[model samples]
Target: MLDPQRTISALRELQRRTGDAQGAQRVAYTAPWHAARGFLTAQLAELPVTVDTDPAGNLWATLPGASDQELWIGGHLDSVPNGGWLDGCLNVFAGLEVLRRLSEQYDGRPPVTVRLVDWADEEGRFGHSLYGSSAVSGHLDPQRAATLTDREGVTMRDALAGIGVDLQHALKAGTQRQKAVAYIELHIEQGPVLERQNLPLGAVLGTCGVERHRVTVTGRAAHAGSTPMDARQDALLVLGRLSQAVYAWTAAHGGVSTIGSVTTTPGIPTSVVETCTFTLDQRHLDPAGLAALWDHAQRDLAQFSADAGCTFAVSPLFQIEPVPFHPALIGACEQAILDVTPQAARLPSGPLHDAAEVARAGIPTVMLFVQSLGGLSHNAAEDTLDAHLDLSVRALDRLAERTITWIRAAERHGARIPAAP
Candidate 1:
C-alpha cells in the first residue's frame, strides 16, 4: 500500500543527511547533490526497477510494465545555494513511494511502463535552469551551455566533466523520451496564494512565460555637491523611474515584474551616477499579456531616458513563451486534488519547472502544487505543514492512477495525445 508517512520520513532523512543549519546544500554538480542522488538510489534498491543516469546527468528509475508506452513522474534533486528542504526532493520521494506501491500491487508489471526521473541541475547552479530536462527535450544548446560559468570561475564544461557528463553528447538525452506519452510532477507552490486562500493543494494550470532583459542608461558624471539638481543628468534617476514604471505597468497588465539587480558606475557617494544598469524580469500566463508588458517597458525606458538627457539600451537576456499544460492531463490533476480535499484551486505557475520543458517537447504534461509556508522558497525558512505534505502525496498518487487510465484509453481508441489548450 502507498505510505505517505514513509515518504515524509524519507524526506526528513534526506534533509538530515544533506542539509545543514544554513539550509540545503544540494547545489548541482556538488558533493552534497551527489550524496542526495545516492540516497535516492538506496531508496530505490528495495523496488523492482532499473536505474541509470543519462548523458545529461538526469537520473531515471524505470518499472517495466506490459506496454512500452511510458508515463513519467519527475522533479529535480538539486537546489539553489541555501535552498529549502522540500523545494525539489519532495516530488522525488513522493514518486518513490508511489512506485513502491505500484510495484507491490502489480508484481512489478503494470499496464504501461512508469519512469521516475530526477532531472539534473534544475536549480541552475551555473545560471542555466532546467539544464537536464531542457537537454532531454532537445531545447538546450551545448555550445552556449559550455560557455556558462559559476561564481568560482569553473566553466560548465569542466563541471560536467567532473561528473563524467560530456557536454557534447548531452543532446542525445532526448532519446530517453522516445516512448514517453505523458509527464506529471509534484512541487511546492513556493508562493503565498494557496496559503492565503487557506488551501492545501492546487492543480497547476501552466508555467508562465518570462521576459528577462538588462537595461543600461548612460549620462555624464558630475560632482554631487557642485552639480545643481536641475543641471545634473543622473542616470540613476532615470533607472529608478524605469523601475517604478515597470511595476506599475506590470500591475496594470495583470502580470508581475521585478527589478532584481542594480548597479551604478560611480563608486563614491560624492559623485553623480554616470551610468546605471538593472535587470528586469517580467512574467505572465498569457503570451499577449507578456508581450504587452515588454512593450510598455520599452516605451517607458525611452521616455524616461529622454527626459533625463540620458541614452538607454536594452539587451535581451532570456525569454520563453507561456507553456499551457495538456487539458486532459490538467483535468486529471484537478480530479485527483478534489479526491483528497474539498476544494482544488487551479493556478498558473509564476515559476518554471521541468514540466514546462517536457510539455514543450510535445509530451502531455501537468503539475500538482503543495502549499508553501510563508510563501517562501530558495531559503532555509521555506516549509509546509506535514498534513499538507501527506495530502499532496495522496493526491499525486491519484493523479498517477488517473493518468495511467487516460493513457490506456487513448491507446485503445487510437486517439492522439491532446495538445495544451
Candidate 2:
C-alpha cells in the first residue's frame, strides 16, 4: 500500500543526515551530494527495480512491466549551497514511495514499465542549469558545457571526471529515453500563489519562457562637483529609467521582470558615472507575451538612453520559449489534485524544471506543485506544511495511476500522444 508517512519519514531522515544548521549542503559534485545519492541508492535496494547511472550522471531505477513503453517520474537530488531541504529531494522520495506501492500492487510487474529518474546537477552549481536532463534530451552542447566552471575554478569536465562521467559521451545518454512515452514530476511551487489562494496543491500549466539579457549604457564621465546635474550624461540615470519602465510595462502586460543586478563605473563618490551595466530577466507563460516584453524593454532602453544622451548595447545571455505541458497529462494531474482537495488550482511555473527539458524532447510531460510556505525556495527557510506535503504525495500517486491508465488506453486505441507546445 502507498504510505505518505513513509515518504515523509524518508525525507526527514535524509535531511537529518545531509542537512546542517546553515541548510542543505547537497550541492552537486560535493561530498554531501555523493552521500545523498548513496542514501537514495540504499532506499532503492529494497525494491525489485534495477538501477544504473546514465552517461550524463543521471540515476535511473527501473521496474519492468508487461510492456516496454516507459512512464518516467523524475526530479533532482542536488541543491544550491545552503539550500532548502525539500526543493529537489521531495519529488524523488515521494516518487520512491509511489514506486513501492506499484511494486506491491502489481507483484513486481506493472501494466507498462515505470522508471524513476534522479537527474544530476539540476541546481546548476556551475551556472548551467538542467545539466543531466538536457543531456538525456540531447539539448546540451558538450563544447559549451565543457567551458563551464564552478566558483572554485574546477572545470565541469574535471568535476564530471571525478564521478566517471565523460562530457564528450554525455549525449549518448539520450538512448535511455528510447522507450519513454511520458514524463511527470512533483515539485514545490517555489512561489506564493497557492498559499495566497489558500490551496494545498496545483497542476502546473507549463514552464514560462525567459528572456535574459545584459544591458550596458555608456556616457562621458566628469567630476561630480564640476558637472551640472542637468548637463551631465549619467549612464546610471538611463539605467534607472529603463528599470522603472520595465516594471511598468510588465505590470500592464501581466508578466514579470527583474533588474537583478546593477554596476556603475567610476566608483568614487566624487566622479560622475560614465558607464552602467545591469541584467534584465523577463518571463511570461505565453510566447507572444514574452516577445512583447522583450520588445518593450528594447524600446525603453533606446528611449531612456537617447534621452540621457548615452549610448546603449544589449547582449543576450539566455533564452527559452514557454513550454506547455501535454494536455492529457495536465488533465490527469488536475484530477489527481481534485482527489486530495475540494478543488484543483492551475498555474504556470515561473521556475524551470527537468520536465521542461523532457517536454522539449517531444515527450509528453506534466508537473504537480505543492505549496511552499512564504513563497520561499533556494534558502534554508523554505518549507511546506506537513499536511500539504502528505497531500502532495497522495496526489502524485493518484496522478501516476491516472497516467498509467491513460497510456494503456492510448495504446489500446492507437491514439497519438500529444507533445509539448
Among these predictions, the greatest TM-score belongs to 1
**TM-score of each model, in listed order:** 0.93, 0.90
Give every collision pair in model 1: none
lDDT of 1 by residue, 1-421 (tens): 9999998998888889888998999999898999999999998998899999999999999999888889999988999889899998999999998899889889999788999999999977766778999999999989988987776889989999999999999999999989999999999999999999999999999999988887889998999899999998999999888777877877789979988778898857999999998878889999999999999988988998999999998876557789999888888899999999999999999998999999999999999999999999999998999999999999999999888888788777776463322
Which sections of candidate 2 miss by over 4 Å? 149-155, 216-235, 262-277, 306-313, 414-421
lDDT of 2 by residue, 1-421 (tens): 9999998898888888889988899999789899999999998999999999999999999999898889999998899988999998999999999899999999999998999999999987766778999999898988988987777899899999999999999999999989999899999999999999999999999999888887889987999998999999999999878767887889888778989768889867998889998888889998889999999988888988899999999876556789999887898899999988898899999987989999999999999999999999988899999999999999999999888888788777776453311
Candidate 2: deviation at residue 206, Å?
A: 1.2
